[model samples]
Target: MKTDTRPILSALPEILKDRCGAFICCASYEERSRCISGAVKDLPFERVVIFAIADIFSGIEDRALEIKSNFSNKTNSEIVLTKTHEPLFTANVVAKSLRRIMDDGINDIFIDITTFTHELLLILLRQINRFKDRLAKVTCLYTSARSYSIGDPDDRKWLSKGCKEIRSVVGFPGLLVPGRPTCLIVLVGFEHERATRTIVEMDPELLLIGKGIPSVEHLTDESHKAPMEFFHNLVQTMVSSRGSVEPFEFSCREPYQTARTILELVTKKPDFNHIIAPLNTKISTVAVALAAMANQKIQVCYAEPETYNFNGYSEPGDKVSIFDLDWDREL
Candidate 1:
């Protein structure tokens, strides 16, 4: 990780100028289409591809039209609708779309995984690794909310309806061999209730990784403390504690390193069941996704929030961390 943080205005010129990018997002009842469209409108891309779930196309019709309208006058934009439930199928569709763009002679690419599910991220990362040599540079983008709402009690729907609670990440084909040490590697984030559910449900050897005490500048001190403490308490609540929770510095953050660490620590043990829940930074989520791609026995799970604080979760903060990965070198 480098100190590449900048405001969206400062960052967009460099990232989106003359670059062919794809925005893989989920459309819901909320303002998700607006969120996706709003960001892409600012970018000066040669071509932009929007990948969304079929349900999103049908369910969020008006916003979808608006998104298309937003980009119609600017760049040559296209929307690819896919079956969001099937990870492998979705990956195949996205891969073909990206390859078609490459066939059109656009090499340098950026992927906005901000609205993607953990499974979607995993498969897409795997697809990117496959086509690494066809591109000059690859950059992954994510939008982090300033504050996440636990949600109002009256809300009954999820913001990301396209996501799956649990899925078998591709590259992991079969069940784990018997008598293996099953481990659950969790990247701790804000949700205590979700984290607790994961701990209770999986019951694997717990391996926790989270941000350091004094986290990054963007996160409020109170907001940061809550998640860290929640992780600690969740671990303590476990009757058979696996071990200690680990912390990583914001500046030294390495998604690939984090993924590689998980492989070195658990997968290499042989005959293991790796269940990863990435509730941390998008970069860290990428790390976990990479790890899931490395082996066939691993499973990735996500517990989507019932409701989002759409109003409170402000965006495009002072800093934007750009996580770069050279697939050939890293993988």
Candidate 2:
């Protein structure tokens, strides 16, 4: 059966119309094509400029050319495909190329680079800002297929710290750095305990299993029975006490299924306030593009992690203690 991807494509029109620029980055050629197809279906292709990288370029060129050749092509959107043999290694060069493209009177651009790393994204982001006058709005997309858990102590510390640092530097509002390891964040109100419980219970345990750790042999079976039971119980407890919760999961790899799943949930529950995502390079560029296209109040949070500090120029003092946590009367 074909995958039901309507949820992801639903809010795209609003996002495209509201923003002056859009960028989509994916991990693979196939995903790039799929994302492009879905994105173009709703966006105003007449003013759009798509920049495809490497193997993805080859696949999209055929479609782009065919579209250009067709008489019914009512839009003036242009698709430029380029090859990058060593993408991550040459991010600075790629950023310069992108800057040149943006300078060519094209305000809206979509970039697809799922093969690169978070550091490369940082480089690109830095460069994009260099030509901010030419670019009114910029959107970065990221994609990954796995799901991560926030339960890991080490992972939480890294993400929380990273988010704080990025916010201190960038100052973009609505900065949501979810604590979950998976990139998907679920916003459930205090009242939807039953539904939340059921959804969590149905989640696959294998989805939560991380790398290096031994895979649970019975994950599939156990997940089928009640994969997110522990999660649901925890949520139920939190809700019963009148506390609200926002839970997210970050996957380690590309083409994150968790993102797709969360998009589906949002479609069914449009009443939810908003979805906040961290503007980290680790996320798939395609996913970022997809999120940008959504109609909800989009907020970008920037964080420059202390781990990236060099020359002893780290942010002075401990920023972690600033968070609203009670250490004196601890549990």
Candidate 3:
């Protein structure tokens, strides 16, 4: 990708300001409102497609509509997505639609990935990889949350109320042979127990923790990662009984570097089936997806929450992270 990373909107790069074509994003309840609005204000995107997710949770359904209403005027077209059917099916549906648009001369694509679920994003990448050769100048837009409204370290709750299940994301079913043990790699996020639950459910032989490196740009001020720090300590105890727990650092700001780091980490454990849980920033999620897509032996997984903390999820940060797609990678 390019090294021209603009820190904020004020120092807008000529590319984002001049040529943001076909903007696509979810009409999400939380940070999406901030991302879409922010992009519209700073960038001159030619057309926009907003997906209003028809979520099973009533809490998200109503709130997601509010964003749809606000952006409906600015949006070129609005589509609703239903995930109750299946993630594999849903991802292909979106990917095929995007491919069609690409066929119709919409080339310079920009995706605001602020609110897409990890299940949707990872699977969609696998589907899109089928036509990666046709992709050109596809970029991802992500807004950082200033902080999450996490409860006390001793409290029973954190970002989400409960975990519904820890299942393998459909599109990325990595290689699981008969004799090879599994290695579960997690890019840890703000959630206190989802990663813990994911580890317990998978019960893999190796656990790798991908923690975001500290940053001075409002990110290090992200509540000093009190919740996740406490979480890592808890997980260390769990891994002590099983396989070894290895901790690695990744950049929350730069996705390509994070992707390289993940590939390198998984490459060392050649004897195990690699399963990645992307629970960190959207940029890092992009990294995890890229690494897995480039290597089919590497699988990506997600911990689906039973219900999100609607009242106190997060407030959007001022900065945004952008990553250009490297479609030339053989998938």
Candidate 4:
């Protein structure tokens, strides 16, 4: 199947008119998650699973229950509150559900990727990719935000507050080198603190800062320009001693392009042990997963948050992008 990406308004029901046999999504405090879930509420769903992650400080139980009530669980649906940070546990829940769906002979699925944590989203996508052989259609739906962290931008009050741990994703631990300087490539987002915190923790010898390009077709420019510049300024302050801190641009909306962009960076710095830490949008993390999976030499890392600013993370945008993704597509 061909990979088709479509960015549309939720008001246009005619676009996602096709029925979905199963739905998978994470319950999050962000308004965009609610908007995306509501937008797909009318779609026919025999099974639905809303993963409510119970990490130490993030609070989202109420919202998960609210979202569960709106969807059609004609056959069965569940709100599983998994009590662990292990990415494989999340993978197992999704894998078990996929196995059941395949047992029932359903080959199509819809995944709402609006508010999954970067780490969680990567795990889910990898799991979905594993079952691509049995599945016919994998449609990923995401709602772009109108704005992020409505409060003071520098404070980043609405995003995560502090970094809990900086580590490689469970399955995506890239290769190690006996004698090589480490180069950390970060996909910067609204949370400037987290990116800076990652540098403080990893102490990578070199740095490649990834600032988003607003040129993406799905996401309009300028709304993100000011903050992106802010992100660049803070992340560059790390001052890598081995090589000068470099800056790179990638589409904030497109995944494959960003994957290639990261790959190009990896090519230029072959002497260094490459580590990709994504503190960016869910969409860009999609790129991180694609890039890391494509190149085992590229390890993907995350700065797990100590706490999130659940008060005001983001408000939902009117536009929603739906991708009929072929998980098995070569990168």
Q: How many steric overlaps are in each model, in order? A: 1, 33, 0, 0
lDDT of 2 by residue, 59-169 (tens): 556655443443122354455444343434445455656655665576655443433333344345545555656764454332221222222321121221222122211
Q: Residue-wise lDDT of candidate 4 within 164-243, one digit each (tens)?
A: 77777767888979789999898887777788888767778888888887554534334767776666766666454436
- Candidate 3 residue lDDT tens string, 36-128: 554464454555555555664555555555554554345544455658336766776677667656765767777777777777767656666
Give the per-residue Cα lDDT of candidate 4 at 45: 75
Highest TM-score against the true fold, candidate: 4
lDDT by candidate, in order shown: 0.56, 0.34, 0.68, 0.74
Flag regions of model 4 displaced more than 4 Å.
1-12, 56-59, 153-158, 216-221, 238-242
TM-score of each: 0.74, 0.34, 0.85, 0.90
Q: Residue-wise lDDT of candidate 1 within 86-131, one digit each (tens)?
A: 6667777878877877776766666655566555666677777787
Candidate 4: residue 287 lDDT (0-100) = 79
Decide which is better by lDDT, 1 or 2. 1
Worst 10 residues of 2 by lDDT: 318-327
The alpha-carbon deviation from the true structure for residue 128 of candidate 4, after best TM-score superposition, in angstroms, is 1.2
The CA root-mean-square deviation of candidate 1, after full C-alpha superposition on the true structure, stands at 4.9
Better of 1 and 3 by lDDT: 3
